[model samples]
Target: MVRPLLRQLLAMAIVGSTAGCLITDRVEFEDPENLPPLIESMAPPAAKVVRLDRTRSEDVSFACQVLDQNEEDTLDARAFLDFARDEAIRGVTEVVQSESDARRRSVTASFPPDLFARGCHVVEVDVIDGGAAGWDPGGQTRFRSVKEGVAKATATWFVLAYDSEGDPRADISLESCP
Candidate 1:
């Protein structure tokens, strides 16, 4: 099963990287179909599990292939398997996952490090009795929360313009500072 998953992942990576030069600012985790045709045989027709982490929650072997939606930007430059609670901001395990340069268009980023030189971190969620799960492109990402205050992870995007001093600060998001 693991071998098949890895093969599928590899095939996706090759297709993504070689299809063409990226020219926009988009993020994807496989292309053409953008996902495996099926995950579990019983899974719904619409569901494709692109990346999965099953078994132990405390120690995860995280790996995934990602695509740069466009060639003009670096959205794929920073990829992460972020696990957090409802509160967010805090009590989150922001693993500094790696990526190939958006210059490359697509990459297979992993915690163990390959493709890109980006860094990775050891994440330990404080909550062990419970876990959380999140997905983009729907039904792709499945993670068992090691433990965190967040009931689960949700999607939110924010960008920071110039601050009061006109200096850029990523901490100061434009979304009313929320």
Candidate 2:
């Protein structure tokens, strides 16, 4: 009876190890407190989305752009735009890639007249490949949109930081011009 039990235990162990052999698709990101090595050293960190408000009758708009400070479009600009559009709260516009630098990537999202509201709007500011860590077609920086009241009439900013291991360490929230 003892011998049979030992064999059974060995078989179970082998099976468990084999099952865990496959790579698990998990990527860890940071909040606004911690940032990657590359960004942390760069002069003047990128701006954040504070608050967004707009009027419906004119060209009242905000620029949603991304800047690749490394002088190359290392991150997927298109993907970041999609994330902003899909994740932005109501009254938020699309994110557009604006500039690239030797050490940074920036994107600006505009608030169109149709989407602009009167209160504090929520916005998610995702800095795609902030550190040029790597090209991850399946990776992204995600965080909750800044929550502000519609009547406050104040702007805010949020930043998502990442590292080479594809891990984010900080997510920042800031106030912006109306």
Leading candidate by lDDT: 2
lDDT of 2 by residue, 1-178 (tens): 9999999999999988888455778988764342221312111223644322232244332333333333433332221122334642333223233344354433434434444333333333333343333323342433322122101011233322222222332232554322
Q: What tens-digit string does per-residue lDDT give for candidate 1 at 41-70?
A: 111111222222222133222222222233
Model 2 error, position 132 (Å): 12
Q: How many angstroms is residue 3 displaced in model 2 relative to the true structure, after the best TM-score fit?
A: 84
Alpha carbon lDDT of each predicted model:
0.28, 0.35
Error of 2 at 118 (Å): 3.0
Model 2, global lDDT: 0.35
In candidate 2, what residue range of length 10 has the lowest lDDT sum? 145-154
> What TM-score goes with each of the models?
0.19, 0.30
